[model samples]
Target chain A: MTDLEAGREALLDHVEALIAQRGGVSITLAELAAAAGMSPANLYRFFENKEALYEAVAERWFAPKVRAMEEVLASDLPIRQKFYAFYARRLGMICDDYARDPALFRSYLELGQQHIEIVRGFIDLADHFLAELIAEAIAEGYFPGLEIDSAVSLVNLMLQTFCDPELVVMLIHSVSEEKLAIVVDTIFDGLRGDRPSNVRRLTRAAR
Target chain B: MTDLEAGREALLDHVEALIAQRGGVSITLAELAAAAGMSPANLYRFFENKEALYEAVAERWFAPKVRAMEEVLASDLPIRQKFYAFYARRLGMICDDYARDPALFRSYLELGQQHIEIVRGFIDLADHFLAELIAEAIAEGYFPGLEIDSAVSLVNLMLQTFCDPELVVMLIHSVSEEKLAIVVDTIFDGLRGDRPSNVRRLTRAAR
Candidate 1:
């Protein structure tokens, strides 16, 4: 990377740490610059204001999510596996972000409708990709035929579950990557047109 | 109702209306009393303080939700339908509250962990009910055998979609009882062990 790019990345990292620790209130451009071994004036050259700096921080975290979705969609994985991989990767992104710095996650949540709309657009992109995959899978007889709308709705529902604040808090108290995987698998099973072999095991266990 | 009961109900209604209209900040004992056609001093006879009154208001709204879950669990409906009804009712409560006063909903979100934990407890209650229902349904041959833990996680995931702020916001923009019903039906269909006939219709329509 270029020197300027390295400095920009360092500034973002410093800002993310500060935001995670202090939420939205604690960080200032001067502090961020000082942390990066630079001056406030130099920081100003990079970002116009606190909002710009914060937006850049969000973009840095969000870009990877967009890329991950794109890669999953472009991959040759079966529809069901693709869906599971998508949710697993997405949830991992959220869990990691919350663990690293919750304030950045909070910042993303507090973003204006415009920013949310952008995020939603990306979600829609992911949803459309999944919908297409499901349709193709059904056509190929790899999965039982199912309604695309309900399938998309199910995918969206699972995604929302990963994003729930209360669930995040609960997970914090009992953090388990395995449990998260089970949650993902269960959702996929519930959404599928056919039951997995473990369905009987689950039912018997329930009884 | 007795005079005291009637008066207290009136007072609570006014508090709800005011909080819904102007938010938590706009509420005051004097204003609530005035709106309720009672004296501020008389209002204190029924409640300790504003916080107490707010809690009462929440209880008034929340108790019915608990009762609804009980009714769903006790009813003879299939486990999948019961789960759908439970969440659909919960979503209805949120939408009703949001419609009555956006500020009140905002207050609930802003009040931090105490409020959020209360909400989570309600969801946990629902989860327990669902876990039992799934167990019973499986035992009775209503569903294909499934892992109890995985089923509960899936149910929780599907339920969370109804309460997700982002998804709720999206729904509001295109709000309709019909649309909500469709969404709810889609969810139930997705959850059912047997695929619905309309799955093909949904798939084609979504694309």
Candidate 2:
């Protein structure tokens, strides 16, 4: 990586440390720059403003999960195994991140909400993965008769506790890694066309 | 109710209004009493302190849901129907409450964490109901060989987005009433032991 890139990441690390210490992102830009041994003008050159810096921090923290998800989605594993592996990796990373610096993680979620665009890419990426998987599941005769959009919505909603940052922070303690696997397995059960033939499907029938 | 009980309920309503206006419970006892046209000493007669008032509000907000869950548990409906009705009522109430006053709901969640004991009773009550339902599901051969505790954890983890105050607030927008039903139906799919009898069960075998 370039030295400039390394310097920017180092600045983010400092900002994250400040947020963790104060339990929020209440530090001023000048204070952040000073703490990183840089002038305010120098920091501004890297990040247009505090919001920009926060956005960068959020993107940095989430980039790895996005990359990992992409790798999982691209692997040769079956769709069902891909689904399990996808969420298992996410749950583990989020839990570890939360456990390490809960305040920073909380700040990251608040930052995401304050600047929705900051998290939009990640949300859209996950949505894309979920939609693709649902389509594959249907093509494979699983979740038969379920429309892709509705299936995406259902699976996304079911996985929110594990995937949504705000929900993950709230539920991380109760939802251990084992519990996440079970929840994923349960969702797979739903998607596997295993409901008794007698149980009427409540969702709209696919064309 | 006695005249004193009426006065106390009125006080709680006033406190809730203050919290809504401030988007938090930052009002002083004097302010709360002044708003209610009462002396601080009189307010003290009702609640010991700010924490006590917050706890009361938390209890008042959660009371109906708990009562509704109890009714569902006691009703003669099938175990599956009871589960659906239970979460449906909870989802509706929480959504309505969140819509009516987002700030107050946020404050309630913050208060819940600041004072865990305030929410302990509600958690224990729900855990009890979940355990009971899982036992019944087992007795009915729904999730045959699944232990009650594991079943309860799995179901509760799956339902966190709908039931946990913090998670519900985070996800209430994406998870509509229709969506919650679909998710619950998905969970019921998991519990029904319809995994084709070929898939190996990952959970402990019920003795």
Candidate 3:
């Protein structure tokens, strides 16, 4: 990498360490520069402002996760196994972030609508990977009659607790692997097409 | 009602109005007492502390929702329709709470683990109703092999985004009714039984 890029990566290491130490992003630019043995002015050359720095931090934290999800999508595993691995990985990483520094993770999440600009690219990338999987599944004759985009949106919507960072922290403790399996199983059932004929007949008889 | 109950209800009315006006629950006991045209000492007779007051508020808000869900469960609608109505009513009420006052709703939600004591009974009541519906579905031979508690827990876990107060506020906007329908449909398929034979054959062929 170029010297400038190397310098930025090194600086980000210090920033992440300090954030983990403080359990938040409340550390100032000057503090970060001091931790890196540099002047605030030098830090400014790398990151224009605190938000810019945070944007980098968010990107650095988020990009690898997107790549990992993409890797899962590209794997030759059974489609059902791939779906479980994809979400389990996503949930595990976010839960790790929350466990590592809840305050810092929460600040990033609590940025809500305001911080969308910083992380929108990462979000879209991840969603694109998810869409790719859904499209593949549709092509393979799963989720028959469902439009790809709508099906993708619906799956993402249902999986929000597993994917939305804030929900992950609040609700993850209760989410066991068994529960995750059940949910994924349900999604598979839903995507595999209409309700089973036996089920429909039973419902009709009951009614 | 008894005089004491009448007076307490009147006091709660003032508290609710002040909470709405301020967009939070930060109003002091003295302020609430003044708003109710009573001395703080008299207010103490109604609510021993802020936590107690908030508990009453939570109960008042939550009890009706539980009752509403029970009504849905009792209705002669098809099991599938009952499922949709049950969750739609829940998502609707929480979203309404958020729309009316985001700050107050957030404070209540942010109370997190600490606030469980006040809300646990209400939560259990709601879960009971959910379990009842799931048990009914199972009894009708849907989810033929699943245990009732596991089925109910899995369904609840999957629906956390709709039911978890904090997630509801963060995610409610993106959740269209069509999306909710898709999720409920998926859950129905999941609950109704194993993979369809045709889909199984298709998947095996794709492999």
Give candidate 3 misplaced runs (Cα > 4 Å): A96-116, A192-207, B96-116, B192-207
What do the candidate models score in CA lDDT, each in turn? 0.60, 0.73, 0.73
Each model's DockQ score: 0.14, 0.31, 0.36
TM-score of each: 0.70, 0.83, 0.84
lDDT (tens digit, per residue) of candidate 3 on B1-207:
998888878887887777656654366788988898888888999899988877877777787687779788878977876777788777888888778877767755654445677778777787888889988887777776777777776777777767767666766667754566667777776654344333334335656
Residue range with the least summed lDDT across 10 consecutive positions in model 2 chain A: A198-207
Runs of candidate 1 exceeding 4 Å displacement: A17-22, A25-55, A74-76, A101-125, A128-139, A142-150, A163-207, B26-41, B49-51, B96-114, B117-121, B142-150, B163-170, B173-207
lDDT of 3 by residue, A8-35 (tens): 8999899877865765435678898999
Candidate 1 chain A weakest lDDT stretch, 10 residues? A195-204
Q: Comparing candidate 1 with candidate 3, which one achieves the higher DockQ?
A: 3
True lDDT of residue A72, candidate 1: 73
True-contact fraction in model 2 equals: 0.33
Clashing pairs in 3: none
Clashing pairs in 2: none
Clashing pairs in 1: A147-B203, A148-B203, A199-B145, A199-B146, A200-B145, A202-B146, A202-B147, A203-B146
Give Cα distance to truth, residue A45, candidate 3, Å: 3.3
Clashes of each: 8, 0, 0
Number of the candidate with higher lDDT, 1 or 3 = 3
